[model samples]
Target: MYCYVSEVKLVSLPPILCVHLKRFRNDDGFTKKLYDKVTFPETFSTAIFAAGQSENADCLKADEHYSLYAVVVHMGSTMSGHYTAFISSNQDWYYADDSCVQPSTWEKVQGTYGGYRQRSGETAYLLLYRKKSWNSSG
Candidate 1:
């Protein structure tokens, strides 16, 4: 016997995509942080995530790709933590931590992937992706 798994698909995509990950769990009467490793690419197509996407719709084009542009990272535990942001634009990445802002790299952003011994208390909680625009005049 085989079991079928049902998956929810996106019917329409927005110009901007914001993804949020649940990094907290409640056990009994206490809450704890989860450090699961969740990796994502810089760019991806939304067609695979869509159900019965119209082939002729410009918005449904398989060539359409979204690029990761920003991330909101949370550091420390649920009781005491700090928030920071990593932003990418003009081919440059920057890290904003309170009053400090400096240049960063994709490698640094990848560090947000929480797991054992990998930036333990620091993790990405939110992500922002923007769809690429294509010129029709060609």
Candidate 2:
């Protein structure tokens, strides 16, 4: 069962929509990363990964994971060993300034390895389309 938050007109309020993201699970004993089932929307047909990695990866890189490279649609799946970045970070993590909170306009901020590494040039991207929770104040 897949559910999505109401898709408002890009500039509308950011509905309390369900952001479901998936990732590979590994118990290497050295380091482990996992995330909630609901995080980022799986709307992007594009994927991020290592350009030269031709084999398979159901794993997370230490903080060294820099950018998010595009991967073929066929390769961005469970059996393929590719997953969303939120999986490794446990969804409760994100990069914040002195305040420790992502600014508005951030299009559903997500971090690789839980903000230890960034997928967007190690920077947060503005989700210009996403609006904050609306208010019905009179």
Candidate 3:
């Protein structure tokens, strides 16, 4: 009989959190990229991951939250790809692809969630979130 236990906890929270998604994998000596739709919320709560005695545990108990502010999107396969970014500024959204920048919408941002097929247009590679102020209304 074998028993395995895994434990993880957060010791502290930072003002800014960056999340990287694993979109590539090596199989049988071949590197391939995966196009999978991963849904993320505009606002995320970290309270569930807080350790009991972690720094600022009180903030977690009080429902401290983070808001998504930016996303890095990757297009193409593992061999080569192009990168773009969707950024939120003062409640406005913009898409930046190389030297081109244009105003965008939340709907457009959501489109980067990727698809369930190989070579699917764009996929979110990185996500950036900022901790909401304690006094923030939302």
Candidate 4:
């Protein structure tokens, strides 16, 4: 018998979506890390990723949208590095560096796009997205 391959699509979505990127690679006896830059949006629609999405999903309601609230960043090579976080809450952003946490901005968060190192360009390792909620009373 031979192994068969199949493509599986996402049919449902959770209230929260956590996406982790594989940044580390090990081949033979060499360990390498990827420093490719990936562009993402602060707010996005998940309707496209859904399989057999309901017609209501096309309405683009608040519930179908998501906002980026947190990002776990990695700052060094594959062997040695530091992890930091950028979090957003109540329309304010903050950067957590070790024991220090300070107010930050959207422009600061965009610095994590890691292709070429430039002062504070750290790679994003994990992304946390929270679904937008609407008032039920409305």
Q: What do the candidate models score in CA lDDT, each in turn?
A: 0.83, 0.27, 0.81, 0.76
Clash pairs (backbone) in predicted model 4 = none
**Could you give me the TM-score of model 4 versus the true structure?**
0.77
Using TM-score as the yardstick, the better of models 2 and 4 is: 4
Model 2, CA-based lDDT: 0.27
- Model 1 lDDT per residue over 92-123, tens place: 89999999999999999999989887665989
Number of backbone collisions per candidate: 0, 6, 0, 0
- Evaluated against the true structure, the overall lDDT of model 3 is 0.81
Query: TM-score of predicted model 1?
Result: 0.83
lDDT of 3 at 15: 87
Question: What C-alpha lDDT, on a 0 to 100 scale, does residue 17 get in candidate 3?
Answer: 92
Lowest summed lDDT across 10 adjacent residues in model 1 is found at: 51-60
Output the worst ten-in-a-row residue range by lDDT, candidate 3.
53-62
lDDT of 1: 0.83
The digit string of per-residue lDDT tens for model 2 on 47-100 reads: 233233333444322122121211111112233332222111222323333334
- Predicted candidate 3 versus true structure: per-residue lDDT over 21-96, tens digit per residue: 9989999999988787888877767655654555644434436788889999998888898999999987788999
User: Residue 82 error for model 1, in Å?
Assistant: 0.2
- Give lDDT tens digits, candidate 4, residues 3-85: 99995655456778898977788988889877777766787776556646555544333237778899999987778889999
